[model samples]
Target: MPLSINSIAPDFKAHTTEGMIQFHDWLGDSWCVLFSHPKDFTPVCTTEIGSVAKVKDEFDRRGVKLIGLSVDPVAEHMRWAGDILAATGQSPNFPMIGDPDLRIAKLFGMLPEDATGDSASRTAMDNATARTLFIIGPDKKIKLTVSYPMTTGRNFDEVLRVIDSLQLTARHQLATPANWISGEDVVIVPSVSDETARQRFPGGWESPVPYLRLVGMPS
Candidate 1:
């Protein structure tokens, strides 16, 4: 079955550019962003990889770890680093998992269980469904999942914005509003009653409607 929000992220052992890793152990006590590409050396994904490298420090600032996956061997991923650097001037500074056998891809439900063959024999189209991103919390539960079509490049800035919102809302009983970014007013989740909200937001809140109470971003 496909993973959903709140599902415990599946754990696995794999060969990454950084060496062998047990997924859960590598992710101990931190948020994580695990994104995948259809293949190594692909155009759009190369730029995406470089983009992540450029923003890695921001992710680190937020206590989030970044990792990537591609449907190729680690050697190919290493070789592609040169291309990524040439194209975007930034090479990946994080581990990149090599899914040559599609083991991790199928385990994460990115590809069908019946999918077969090593990445060496498959074309990019054959692994198109592998383009997905997962955001996991410190508890190792998936907080979000996004799959992109092969032709589109992902907006990683929005990914950072979401991480900010996720971290904030997780710490407080609030829900971000549409197009919300950090430091903006947030809505009190409906489950938080007025009485509870009062105690939490003792300074006060703005209620344009009965249930749509808006309050400043909590520190």
Candidate 2:
């Protein structure tokens, strides 16, 4: 089954660049972006990790912590991080979990069941990690998830944009519109009862259509 919002993210203990850590313990009091890539020391994964490292400050500003995972060893992570620092002039400030046994990968449903079975000769990733992105809210619930094809790189800008929107809507208790930007007006969720709607939106209630209600623009 696909993971959904409000589901408690599966917890796991794994090796990271900074040593061992339990998932929930590492995420204490901070929102988390738990992302899984197909493998490490590869082309697409290289670019993705570097981009995320570049945006570390933006995520920090929003009180979000990033944790990357894949079925690679701790040694590989150290070498790749060194290479990344040389190439991008920035060191990765986040934890990159080395899940060689697929222990954490399987728990989070990141390892594809049939991916290795279809190969002709040897299966390197029989229990390997898949390229997946999961956004966990501060409440430790899975908020959003994205699974991308191996050929494509994940979009960091889009992720940041969505995070911005989520944080804004969360603080305001209002619903975001079709292409809501930060500081833009938001739509309010109407009540099931007409009287309740009137009570919630008191100033001027006008229903252009049955399902659509227009109140004063948000201040």
Candidate 3:
């Protein structure tokens, strides 16, 4: 079955650029962004990896750990890091999981269980479905998932924005409006009755419509 939001992310043991890791154990108590690429040494993937490396500090500040996956061996990933550095001025600072056998990709629903072949013989198009990203919260449940095509590089800034909304909504009974960013006003979830909302937001809220109550983000 395809994984869904709120489902516990599948765990696996894999070889990474850093070393071997048991996925859930490596995640520990931090939020995590587990992004994958179809193959190593590809141009678009190289830039994507470098982009994450550049803004790694932003993720770190939000208590998010970043890990990458590619359908190639660790040695290949290491070699590709140099090219990534040369092209984008940043090499990946996080562990890059080597999914040469497609085990982790299959477990995470990024590939079919019947998918065949080792990374040695597979082209990027052969593993195209592996271009995916997952955001797992401290509770080990998936909070978000996104998949991009071979031609599109992801926008990590937008990922960060969603993380901000996820963290904020999780803490309070609120839901972010369209294109919401941090410090923007949010809507109280309908589950919170007006009486309860009054107690929660003693400062009051703006009700342009009965079902749409907007309140400033709480400190």
Note each model's CA RMSD in angstroms.
0.7, 3.8, 0.7
lDDT (tens digit, per residue) of candidate 3 on 1-219: 899899999989989999999999999989999999999999899999999999999999999999999999999999999999999999889999998998899999999999988899889999999999999999999999999999999999999999999989889899999999899899999999999999999999999999999999988
Tens digit per residue, CA lDDT, model 1, 105-169: 99899999999888989999999999999999999999999999999999999999999999998
Better of 1 and 2 by lDDT: 1
lDDT of each: 0.95, 0.74, 0.94
What value of lDDT does candidate 1 attain over all alpha carbons?
Answer: 0.95
Give the higher-lDDT candidate: 2 or 3.
3
The Cα error of candidate 3 at residue 75, in Å, is 0.3
Whole-model lDDT for model 3 versus the true structure?
Answer: 0.94
What TM-score goes with each of the models? 0.98, 0.82, 0.99
C-alpha lDDT (0 to 100) for residue 193 of candidate 1: 90
Q: Lowest summed-lDDT stretch of 10 residues in model 1?
A: 203-212
State residue 193's C-alpha deviation in candidate 3, in Å. 0.7
